[model samples]
Target: MSDNSGFFERVYEVCRKIPEGKVTSYGAIAKYLGAARSARMVGWAMNSSHNLEDVPAHRVVNRNGVLTGKHHFGGTNAMQQLLEEEGVQVKKLQILDFEKHFWDPMKELPQEI
Candidate 1:
């Protein structure tokens, strides 16, 4: 595994902790991991999360709560569908009531360092 493999594992751990019906941003996960500018790396980890059954990548989105990675979830609507099933509303590829559903790992998880 590359050094990023550890980063990806950490990302997966954060993603797994996202409660059902809530969501978080790639940037939030990156910042939680101590790399504020590694939002794209968070996205990259998410792209690999599909192989893990419990990663819950559907609970992750862009800062605006847009379903930017929806296409990776098997179809254009798959990610949105999963969110909707969990009680989150999506309209025009954007999460409705985003603030209400937002789950920040930094706020929710206990500090490890």
Candidate 2:
């Protein structure tokens, strides 16, 4: 495995833990991983997450809760569809009531030693 595999694995693990009805920001995941400036890396990991069925890449988004990764999901609406199916509201590619649906890995998961 590549060096980034571990980081990507950590990303996927946190992503898998995201509750079905909630969503999180790439920055949030990055910060949780102790790489607050690596939000783009988190997005890159998500880009490759299609190979992992258990990784809910669609549950991740930009800081604004915008479905920025929607294009990677297949069709333009695929991401939105997935989020809607999970009871998350979307409008103009942005999640409605995002704060209510937001999930923070740092807050929900145990800290690493």
Candidate 3:
């Protein structure tokens, strides 16, 4: 695959590894993919990844735990509901007490995958 395609695949692979109800930022994803400043690129790829079979796009959000991708979700307010159902409290589009629930995959992820 070309570099762009490979990068997207890598993004999807990492995104797929995120557990349900958990969220990670585009910046973090980019960092994990060795593209520390390409968070916007990651978001672009995600926005265009409608057919990806493995990426749970809903489980990814902004660095502040904001549901910035809610517009792309399948149902109205589905992203928030999904996170809440997963035990995350959300208010005004903010993940309540984000420091408590944010999953730093960079630190928590295994060295080898």
**Ten contiguous residues minimizing lDDT sum, candidate 1:** 104-113
lDDT of 3: 0.81
Residue range 20-40, candidate 3, lDDT tens digits: 767788998888777889999
Residue 61 accuracy (lDDT) in model 1: 97
Worst 10 residues of 2 by lDDT: 104-113
Q: Per-residue lDDT tens digits of candidate 2, residues 33-64?
A: 89999999999999999988889999999999
**What stretches of model 1 exceed 4 Å from their correct place?**
none
What lDDT tens digits, residue by residue, belong to model 1 across residues 1-96? 688999899899889899999999999999998999999999999999888998999999999999999889887688998999999999999999
Which residue pairs clash in candidate 1?
Answer: none
Query: Over 4 Å off in model 3, which ranges?
Result: 111-113
Backbone clash numbers for all candidates listed: 0, 0, 0
Model 2 misses residue 8 by how many Å? Answer: 0.3
Q: How would the candidate models be sorted by lDDT, starting from the highest?
A: 2, 1, 3
Q: Report the lDDT of model 2 for residue 27.
A: 98
